[model samples]
Target: MNSLIEDVSPIAVDVYRSRRERVLAQLRAQGGGLAVLSTAPEVMRNRDTDYPFRHDSYFYYLTGFSEPEATLVLNASARDGEPASILFCREKNVERETWEGFRYGPEAAAEAFGFDAAFAIGALDDHMPRLLADQPALFYALGTSAELDAKVRGWIDAVRAQSRSGVRAPTRAQHLLPIIDEMRMVKDAHEIAIMRRAASISAEAHRGAMHACRPGMREYELEAELLYTFRRHGAQAPAYGSIVATGANACVLHYPAGNATMRDGDLVLIDAACELDGYASDITRTFPASGRFTPAQRELYDIVLAAQSAAIDATRAGVSFDALHQAALEVLSQGLLDTGILDKAKFGGVENVIAERAYARFYMHRTGHWLGMDVHDAGEYREADGPRDEQGARPWRTLVAGNVLTIEPGLYVRAAEDVPERYWNTGIRIEDDALVTPGGCELLTREVPVAADEIEALMRESISH
Candidate 1:
């Protein structure tokens, strides 16, 4: 067992310690191995400067350590009785601290971050061989880090050198991500609390952006409003690039805020959110940049909103993962037919449009994705057992109580002779975070208005003053 300081983070130390214990149990179950994971390497933005540092999600999940150039080793070897959870990190340097920031060093890190033992990172090569000796397997993620792979090889090679002395290198290897990914998929009470705060902050930013938007403003000006709101409320940073698309710009799904000017009679689509602590919250809302949706714009906006509602209703524990997407798709496919986007005479009906995936012309992306640590998060979507469906592919897993996801359904209409001119260049998307529960799903980002009427009212009120 590792030593713990009660105040490691907003999350209790016991949670991380328990997670490490679970990994140990998994390792022991696999006949004793050394579980090794390293934090992300810091990348240089330019000469003598670096990009913002973020820890590797897997490493942070178990260690709760956020520093760069750090590694964790969990030894569960029966023969080599050794440290269960060990940390290797940077040693304290006052000169470096003055230029950079505080360094926990080894002794302080061991006590403060609750590791069984800690040492300067430079000593990993020297100590790894000893840890590798007599172990049955070495557990590390495959295709993750070349440096780690090289180090593991060197450690085993060092141990093999002493084989004549009865020292045995590991004969087996295993991937640690599968186990850790499953753990991250389910939200614990601590993670849920942090996510709720992130959602609230992001919701406020979306609401503010809608209020600040006007017909004459540049897209970047609206984006600045979002940044201001996120930081003003104490968010660390944007979870992803903020998309402040106006008019035809929204037709590009991944478009970031540009110099494009918002004009009257155009819809403004914003897909933005904040990362509070290490957790992330995501939300997207499309509204009229002029504080009023044109007749055609409101018609299409209502369709997208209704599709999102169907998807939200389909999200709950025991529902298959694809059920929600299919629910939204069915609604969207019908809407496309109703709007004649997919010519009703040529495409036949909703059944044929879905069968042909014809709705992709306007609504291309999936309804949503699992939302957590990374914006896309970490988790296997399909049943790991094997393919059981008639399509000969593995089926998506059923929704569980602890799961959280987004319900985003959108429409991007490009100009064409056959397409209606009024609907051309109109891109509308509505997104919200949903927490799956036994009874139903909770819409975490609803604090920002979703209904077309509510959005119009909020915008008109803000602009009136």
Candidate 2:
């Protein structure tokens, strides 16, 4: 392995090679074909500046190639009786290298990334036609990119042009997302190790935010604490934009403008996590800015904490994905009725409230989402069960070992005429990443305090020290 590549990525070379071999085996089972994958294109942030470049998930899954302007080609059925993994990448240019940084040209990329054959990206148009000829099928992310779609069409046309000269273009075209998505859904040992590290780093960052938060401070100030912790621990970036919502702002699910000043009596809700080695960890913690929750705030916070506990308990193998959501909903519905938030006479009862989904007014979003390479990671939530219903309800998939997901249960009480005045403007959510196991599940983000008293105590200790 090259020292440069080793220093950049913690993933071993054999791990990447093994991933390619597994994908090739799956392709062979599908009767063999040629699959093409490309990295994300660089985008302009402004007139002359460019946004940070991140490679496409699928391309990186197999090749681990991070450079822009690169494409991976996998030929499962090769004419030479050996499978071929080819890479097309930027060639070395002294002038470009002077301005930019070093590029692993064709030779270095092939050796470093475990590709059998390598070519300059400039030759893709000339080489793709020959590569496409005589293949039984063509596999690519159909409809993903207009440029790539046109390039594939042009390559097919080039192959068809040679039809009379004893060449044949692929008659079958298939979408490669489902095949790769399934492979990525189950985390291998290596992926789990990296994810554990990511979770640990993010957990400490959340703790830091809780400790650093103070009344009269801006939300972005707390956000800065989180960013510092992530980068200080070697995380690449936040999995998503950090949400630092205080008081009423927490009522908004995806609030990005975290500029409001926190009040002494307000509760701050932070939904933030970081990405390490391309694996993501998502965690959310809601705590009082004054280091102690008031009576009404503690009431709502305890309810949300209980609901999250129920959902986490249900995250186990053989359970359907919706089961966890249903468990959390039941707990939240009962809690709302127990409190004055939901009127028993108007909503009829806890059972009727759940049936009518009346709880959505206060807890609108789903309990949680799949977390992985992307925050809402790939794997489909629905599985084929007979004919689909008219309401378009797909059957939920059963959880399996190695599946990592978040259990987040929240309650947002905005100012409403019918809502209890005491509970208004109080939003609380407790989220933690859980890995399903045969026995039950393991909470990856458990190091951060979730209990109300524990959170208060931790904050107080930080201040006194």
Candidate 3:
């Protein structure tokens, strides 16, 4: 952890507090219950070392506190004496504090995080039975955590043991994430601000990667540049494994940056981004390692760029999520036909190729996905409980204001007798973060050049400098 973490609270305390209140209100409406959630446990990476601890998204949504072995208990059925929100966390130990940074203890955590009450984590088992007794319902994800499930059962059993004394466990249990996911999908102003900054930071990293790229550089060297740029720009880390694929390696979608040397005639596909605070921004750009795209490569690049443009154009309030993907797919299908990547005589037309998925040889994967705290952020993609269409699928959810997603359309041509030899081993992907608005959508990762000519210009500038 760095000092940057202390500054992670760009969203005011009231935002998390308000979310907790909303969860409590939902619980109260559903016959009142206690909702219990625990932060992620710190896992041991090896014999003595430990993996970097990350707080659980669900727990952090309600409480901004970022400590492991912490649990939040919200009692919707609290009486006049009981507080609505309670947090139980690791007890303070001076010896442990000397080794492991700070622990809020209980009183400090309650005050710092706006909880009504708090206690040591050690007391949770002792207190859960009393908290669960006679509640109408319990709210938590049922099967996500085996450890949490075992603890929940023990609490329920403890309440059951008191049945002779006229106490009863909760009668019903509800999954909590669906409600939370719904809340998380729509980016509020605070979240959007963080995401915007993240996008800016990541855009700079991409630019840096392009600048450092050159002929005869190993793929890993370009990757190192990306990582250095991310951290240098105050980002905690890369959003995901930085994909710095060079030459034919670009054909592998999730190719890890390795020892493959970037050659003069090859293209590098960089699918990377950065994380700021907790939100993630994703961007992918493909460009020539020699600072110039060949005719064949430039043609593929233009097609993917045009497809991304179509998808971005279709992204707005009231459009289905799938509609944006369809928009990109149509453009890409047409591009494949024009380029001879998909035989026009065999595929007939763009619609026929799409219906048959004949263009899948060079283009696969969806156009984009929901993006936020997690790269593939939470939220149902399709309409819940809607009647199945003739495709036997539920309708995709319509886009609304505050929804953020990615518009990434790509083409990967592999060596095949059926494929044009000139287009072989070329991969191009143009990705940008799209924030849906009333008019259309805002492109977040536009700081980096996506246009083929612009990329060549940026690379030339990089080489001269």
Candidate 1: segments with Cα more than 4 A from true spot = 1-11, 78-81
Worst 10 residues of 1 by lDDT: 1-10
Candidate 3 residue pairs in backbone clash: none
Compose the digit string of candidate 1's lDDT tens values, residues 100-199: 8877889988877677889999999999998889889999986788887888888989999999999999899899999898888889988898899999
What are the per-model numbers of colliding residue pairs? 0, 0, 0
Model 3 stretches astray by more than 4 angstroms: 1-11
lDDT value, residue 429 of candidate 2:
88
TM-score of each: 0.96, 0.97, 0.97
Across residues 279-314, which tens digit of lDDT does each residue of candidate 3 receive?
899999999999999999998888898998889889
Q: After superposition, how far is residue 312 of candidate 1 from its true place, in Å?
A: 0.6
Overall lDDT per candidate, in order of appearance: 0.89, 0.89, 0.90
